[model samples]
Target: MIILYDISCTRHNTAWSPSTWKTRYVLNYKGLSYRTEWVEFADIEALSIKHGFAPSGKRADGSPRYTLPAIYDESTGAKIADSSLIADYLEATYLDTPSLYPHNTRALQAAYEAAVLAHLDAIHQFTAPYLMTKKYFTPKTEEYYRKFREPAFGGKRLEDLLPFGAERVKQWERLKNDIGKIAAWYDKNDRKGSFLLGETPSWADFVAASFLVWLRVIWGEESEEWKDLETWHNGRWKKLFAAVKKYEAMA
Candidate 1:
């Protein structure tokens, strides 16, 4: 069995981090047996250190930065951090299961993931404020998140990052337009499929879907923003989300 580490959220105990969602999608799609271990934002670094999990990245000061979406593979006694690395480990270890990178498309899939994330800047900016709300995070985690992220936004209060009214509307429009650009990429697909590579589901789809899932989780399905998103680009996002919805199981 595998122990997948995920960032905890206050809403329904669901896994909400987009990075972690990528791993969850891979695990579920491959039919792997795993259980989620929810960790508070404040504890991620300590947890990583305790388990000897590799740092996910580096901080601005070049200090090692630890994050969740890590995994402990009980079967192999392997502890891995970072979503992409976890996917690679799983792909290499589970030969019998379906591959996330099929037909030697690992490089292409990695590029696609980077491309998709590059276009998500507006979405990230627009959603940051909502993510800081007390409704989304526990007390301690929220405090940690705010302290850790406020500096990035020039020390502005989370709500001030994108205030409501005209500014918020402008940011939302930017997000929608950015999403349209990504949708145009799907339009170039020569065949009809919910995935990036024609009829085959791969890591590329998981990467794209994770952002959509992030949007849905942060905005709430019933929010006007999410509803608007569902109708955009001829409902392509909605369909893509539906196709991968089954793989959203947390465990």
Candidate 2:
């Protein structure tokens, strides 16, 4: 069994972090049995440090800065961090499961994963402030969320970044264009279905779906943001999301 450490809130009672969503998707896609270890934002750094987990990279001061989505494999007493690395570990360890990178396409898988992450980074510019202001967070987690995000916004308050008027429209347009470009590639690939790889879902599908799941978290599923997105590429986002929606049941 694997124990997945996830960032979660008491209100939602489910995994809330986007990065963790990738791992959850992979675990469920492989049909592996795992349990969640939910942690608040405030405790992640300390908890990770206590478990001898080092940061993905060092800060300017060379201090380790840890984040969530780390897992502890009970069967092997092995612990791992980072979503991409975790995916690699899972793939190599569980050869019997459906392959994330079918047909030895590790390089291609890496390329798709990187592109999805880059798009996610852009999406965060608009989603971050909304996440920061959500009322579902506990007091400590809410405090940590604001403080942790300050550096990303150059010490400006998170609430101050909320887009308005033309700025809001511009951000939505950029997001739509981003989705449109990716959907265009999928459209031309001629998959003939929801998945990028035709009938079978692949790592690329998980990567794309993870971003959609993240968006649903930042805004409710019924939000106008989603409504606008549902109209793009003949509802490609909706289709991509439906392909992965079954995994949510596992969570």
Candidate 3:
């Protein structure tokens, strides 16, 4: 069995973190037996270091990296960090499970993953204000989140970025423009199929779905943003969301 380190949200019913969703999706999609360990933001560095993984990456000031969405495989004594590496590791280690990466398409799959992740910063910018202010967080997690994120926001308070009233509408419009790029790409290449690559839900599907899944995690399924996304690119986002639904953890 493997242990997945997930970000904890003590006050929210939905236990999710955007970056971690990719790994969890792969684990569940492959029917791998694993249990999630809830980790707060403050503890990720120490926990990751203890698991024998390197720091996640360098800080803006060249500090050591420490982040979550890491996995410790008790079965093989392998500890992996980073979602892309984890997905590749799982596919290679579990040959009997369904393959997420197509044969000889590792490069393409990586490109697809990159394409989807390209929008991550914008999505986070659109959602972070609401996510930080209203969503679940223990006091420690909240404190750590602010400290870690403030630098990225040009030293502006997270709450200060929240748009309201007319500004909120404008924010949504801008977000839609960013999402439109993705939707347009899908529309051009989908070839009228549900999945990005025709019938199968490949890594491309998982990568694309992870974005909206993160949104759904932060905002409830019934949120206006979720509903609005459903209508994008002729319901393509909605279709992708539905395609991955079966892979989600069963209640």
Candidate 4:
């Protein structure tokens, strides 16, 4: 089983996009062996072209697929696009260890969106201010925000980076506040479960854990807000940490 991951270089990697972290988690959780290839904002499109995969509408070279996070399977001749789609692919491909869609498929997906997606939003709030002045994709490109993430989703950054105006600043504030809500939900919903899907981990936890990984790293250890937020995220972290440790021992 060969898994090709579409990841970012340290220079271009965004703290948001739970999909990226989720992919890494799934790979580690399943104890699957895979190799990672990092792509820059400028070279992503050319790489996609070489691989014949395009997920976004425009490209770094000015063609299309301004999107990132494209995965290809060399063994199966199948390439996967988007973060959510990639989770489904990982779940289906790794059936023996654990399944993302364990039960109550509808609720699982709903929570995934509500919780995991919320983390993505929070990540945006945490990082967007810094990203506004800095170019994440390609430094040589004229557009700082990249054409793909431009347009601003309801005055947000999904369409494209629109200068991170006052509207975006307010949007960031709203997203930053959302962290409390996510924690409150976890305090209520998580109960005694080791992972998000009761006992076994799910795609929900896979992506959710990434939020914690970035948050802890981004905020550092002194953040009381981060410590408070851990009521929800820490469980997943402990689980994945143990799994990775075990996997390493196996090596």
lDDT of 1 by residue, 93-137 (tens): 999999999999999888887888888877757677787763677
TM-score of model 3 relative to the true fold?
A: 0.92
Weakest 10 consecutive residues of candidate 1 by summed lDDT: 126-135
Full-model lDDT, candidate 2: 0.79
Error of 4 at 98 (Å): 1.4
- Tell me the whole-model lDDT of each prediction, alpha carbons only: 0.87, 0.79, 0.78, 0.55
lDDT digits (tens) for residues 1-251 of candidate 2: 99999987866556657788889999999998898888888998888988866577665567777877898988878788888888999999999999888888879988877776666435766677776677657888878878777777777777777778999788778877887777886887664778877888888887777777877877777888777777788888888887778877544
Question: By descending lDDT, how would the candidates be arranged?
Answer: 1, 2, 3, 4
Instruction: Kindly give the stretch of ten consecutive residues in candidate 4 with the minimal lDDT sum.
Output: 242-251
Give per-residue CA lDDT, model 3, range 46-119, as digits (tens): 88877787676899989997777888899998888888888989999999998887666779888877776676
lDDT of 2 at 122: 50
Each candidate structure's TM-score, on Cα atoms with residue i matched to residue i, is 0.96, 0.93, 0.92, 0.66
- 65-91: candidate 4 lDDT, tens digit per residue: 544466676766678766667667767
Model 1 CA lDDT for position 176 = 84
Please count the clashing residue pairs in each candidate, in the order shown.
0, 0, 1, 14
